[model samples]
Structures are given as C-alpha cells and as structure tokens.
Target: MATFQRHRAFPWLLLLPQLAIVAIFFFWPAFQALRRSFYVQDAFGLGERFVGLSNYVAVLTSALWQQALVNTLLFSASVALGAMSIALLLATLADRVLRGAKGYRTLLIWPYAVAPAAAGVLWLFLFDPSLGIISRALGSLGIHWNQRLNGGQAMLLVIIASVWQQMSYNFIFFLAGLQSIPASLLESAAIDGAGPWRRFWTITFPLLSPTTFFLLVMNTIYAFFETFGTIDTTTGGGPNNATTTLVYKIYQDGIVGLDLGGSSAQSVILMVLVGLLTLIQFRYVERRVQYY
Candidate 1:
C-alpha cells in the first residue's frame, strides 16, 4: 500500500512544474486583471483609485465597445467556420493521396509552424494593393481589391489572414481523425452499395464529430484571443475600427488609450464570455458528437 501511494504521488510530482507554470502565467495574471477591473489606474502606473463597477458600465455602454463586440462575434464565427471547413476539405483530399502522401501532408502542415505575426505579414504582402502578386491578379480581373480605405474589405482581409493562419492547425487534427477511422468500416460501406458521398455522410462525418467538436471549441478560442497578432500585423483593426475585436479593443484601451480600468474590465468580460462559450459548446454541441 505504501508503494502504491508512492507511485500515485509520483505522477502528481511530475505535474508540479506544469501546475506552477499555469498558476504563474495564467491564474496570477487573471487575478490581477480581476482586481484591476474595479479600479482606474494612472497612465504611468503611479497611482490607482477604486471605482466600483463604473469601468464595466462604461465599457458596456460605449458605442465603440458595442461595435467591437459585434465585430468580435462576426470575426470569431468567420474564422472558426472558414478554417475548419477548408481544413476538412484539405484533410479529406490529403487522406486520399496514394503517392507523395508524406510530402503532401507536410506541405499542408508547414503553415502551422509559422508564427501568427509572420503568417499575417506574408498574407499582407500577398494582398497589398499595388504590386502584390494576388492584388495584381485581382486588378487584372477588375476586382479592385484594396483593404486600406474600405472597411468591409479590411474586415475581409483580417478574416482571411486569421483563417489561413489557423487552417493548418485544424488540418492536422482533421487528418489524424480521418486516418484513425477504421478502413474496414469504409470498405463495408462501399460493399453495401453506399456511394462515396453517402458513406461519407453516414460514416466518415459522424465518426469525425469528436474531432470536429474539439476543433470547434479550440478554433473559437483561437479566433477570440490568438487572432490578435494576426489582425495587428494585417489590418491593425483599422478602416474606422471595422475589424476591432474585443481582444484588440482591450489592448487599445489598456495599453494604447491608457484607460486601464476599462481595459481590465473588458479583459475580465472576455474571459467570462469565452468560459461561457466553451460551456455552451460542451453542453449543446457535445450532444451531436459521436465519440466512436
């Protein structure tokens, strides 16, 4: 029994470092944000005064914050849906590769290794108004693509950058999920007169639900928080604040605008909002997931 207890304690001992890291990096900052939310601080951090819920009220009532909320929802939805859909398609195609499969998958996964800022800059050049390869191609086709002044175009540009940046991550999970599906099941469906599309809908899709659900949650989180670097690099949430997401707004308020209290409130709200979103997904979305 003592040996058993020692063995059980050893696993937790291994986890101590990770726990310390999370506590220091995540929980500590979160606690600071929560505490700071109730107080307005001097721009230079020389002083702070407790202000109750006024910061929250201001953030909730401001038009800019409202617009940021709307933009955040739209951006998150677009990035998550677009990335997952494109990744699923790519994974499906990659799974069918009979030759050069390693190279094909490797190419698909290469983008995931690129930092978000770097990826955004790469796409920025690709879509730059003048002399960009894609921009010139669009101009030749009379599409007149320019993100500088057009708010809608700017939003689209950021969305595309975010989707492209996250798609590689989604692809890896989807490919793994696809490969894990039992080949015999597909063969059985094929033998049963089920067409490819029919078998896919009946077997492949349902089996991939676990992976899809997981990706949905992770991608939503990515869109909410991780897209900041990409959006910053690409659009700067610009063209009249058309692409200003909640995370970006928080940065603008706290770091740029020097409204520390309002920014802390926004950060707290964002954390709670994401937590609720994850719960909602697990509560409602998980019902559709077929683990087997």
Candidate 2:
C-alpha cells in the first residue's frame, strides 16, 4: 500500500508547483474579476456599489459596445484570413518551385520576430500622411490616404498591420506542414501524368487539412485577443472609436476608465465568445483533420 501510494503521489508532487501557481495567479484573479463585475463605480472615485447585473446590462445594451463588437469581429476575421491565405500561397510556392528556400524562409519569419508594438509603430510610419513614402506614392496616383477622416480606411490600415505581423507565424506553420508531406506521393502523382494543379487539389490540399485546422484555431484566438498591442499603438481605438475592438474596449473600460464591473462583464462575454468558437472548431474540424 505504501509503495502504491508513493508511486501515485510522484506525479502530483511534480505537478504541485505548476498547479499552485495557476490557482494563485490565474484562478484567483479570475474569481476576483467575476466578483468585481457585480459592483458599480462612480466618477468621483468615492462611490462603489454592489449593483449586481446593472453594469452588465448597461454595457450590453450600449450602442458603443455593439459597434465595438462588430468592428472587433470584422478586423480579426480580415486579418486572419488575409495572413493565412498569403502564407499558404507563399508556402506552396516555396515547397514546389523554389530551390534553396532558406533565404525566403528567413525573410518570411522576420515579421513574427518583431514585437507587436514595434510592428504597429513601424506600420504607422509607413502610412503617415506627411512625408511618408506610401502616402506620397498614393498622392502621386491621386489617391488621398487619410486614415484619420475615413473610418473604413482606418480599419483597413489596422487589418493590414495585423496581417503583416502575423504572416510570419502562418508561413512557418504552413511550411512545416508542406515539408511533412511525403515526396513519394508527389512522385507517384507525376508518374500518373497528373499536372501540378491536379496533384495539389487531389492530394496536397487534403493532407494539409490538419495544418489548416490547427491554424484556424490558433489564428482565431490570436485575432480575438492578442491584436490589442497593434490597435493600442497604432489607432488607440480612435477616429471616434472606429477601430475599437472587444479586447481594446475591455482595456479602455477596466484600466483606463476604471469601470471595473462593466469591463469584467465585457471580459466574460469575450470569454464566452472564444469558448464557443473553440468548441465549434473542435466539433467540426477535429474529425476532418487528415493524418498521413
């Protein structure tokens, strides 16, 4: 009995530290945020009341919240789609056409190495209205590039910046997926007189389904949460809150505005949205992932 107990306890002993840390840092804070969400805050910083659901109701019913939510979803979707599609195209090209692809691979992964804030700042300079190369070029073509005045243009800039930053990660994963495919299969397809396009559609794409599934989950989560730095640095969710995302709104509310309850409610909503997406992805995509 002692020997069995010792064996059983060994794994727990190893995991105890990590479990303790998670409970302390993650769960404790989460519980606190939940509790805070039930309370109300006033402007003078002198009033805090336990209003239970009022804050949530206010936030959910607000027009600004609705607008922000839509903007967030649109921006994230565009950036993920743009980055993943470009990365897949580049990966396919590299795998099939290019000899000595190391240089191109290095260039592709460079953007992923950059910090999000830095990437945002870099993109800001690139699109700056005065004395900016891109702006000047657009001006020469009679296209006035004013991100401040046009909300659609501002959103487009944010999406482009985000996609540029994320393309490297997508590229690396797709490249790895491509490299993992067996060369013998391609050789067999060639022997059968299959054209490149035919082989790619019939064999390559089906095998790449697993990689696509993984990328979709990760990219969705990233778009939903981690694009905040880019938004904050570049747009500050600005131009009359045109670029305000859900995560950005949460930050503005909780940290900047000190509307703890409203912020927490927003957070909980965001969490629920992400959870639903993850669940759907697992349910629909897991079975479809092809393993060779």
**lDDT over C-alpha atoms for residue 22 of model 2:** 100
Per-candidate total of colliding backbone pairs? 0, 0
Off by over 4 Å in 1: 1-13
Writing each residue's lDDT as its tens digit, candidate 1 over 35-88 gives 999998989889989999999999999999999999999999999999999999
Relative to the true structure, how large is the alpha-carbon lDDT of every model? 0.93, 0.87
Q: What does the lDDT come to for candidate 2?
A: 0.87
Give lDDT tens digits, candidate 2, residues 1-292: 7776769878898999999999999889888778878887675658788998887899889999999989988988898899999999999988765676888889889999899999888888888888568878998999998777778878988899999988889999999998998999999999999999998888888899889888888888888888999988888898899999999999998889977789988888888888998999899878988877
User: Candidate 2 deviates by what RMSD?
Assistant: 2.1
TM-scores, one per candidate? 0.95, 0.94
Q: What TM-score number comes out for model 1? A: 0.95
* Pairs in steric clash, model 2: none
Off by over 4 Å in 2: 1-5, 42-47, 97-99
Residue 47 shift from truth in candidate 2, angstroms: 5.5
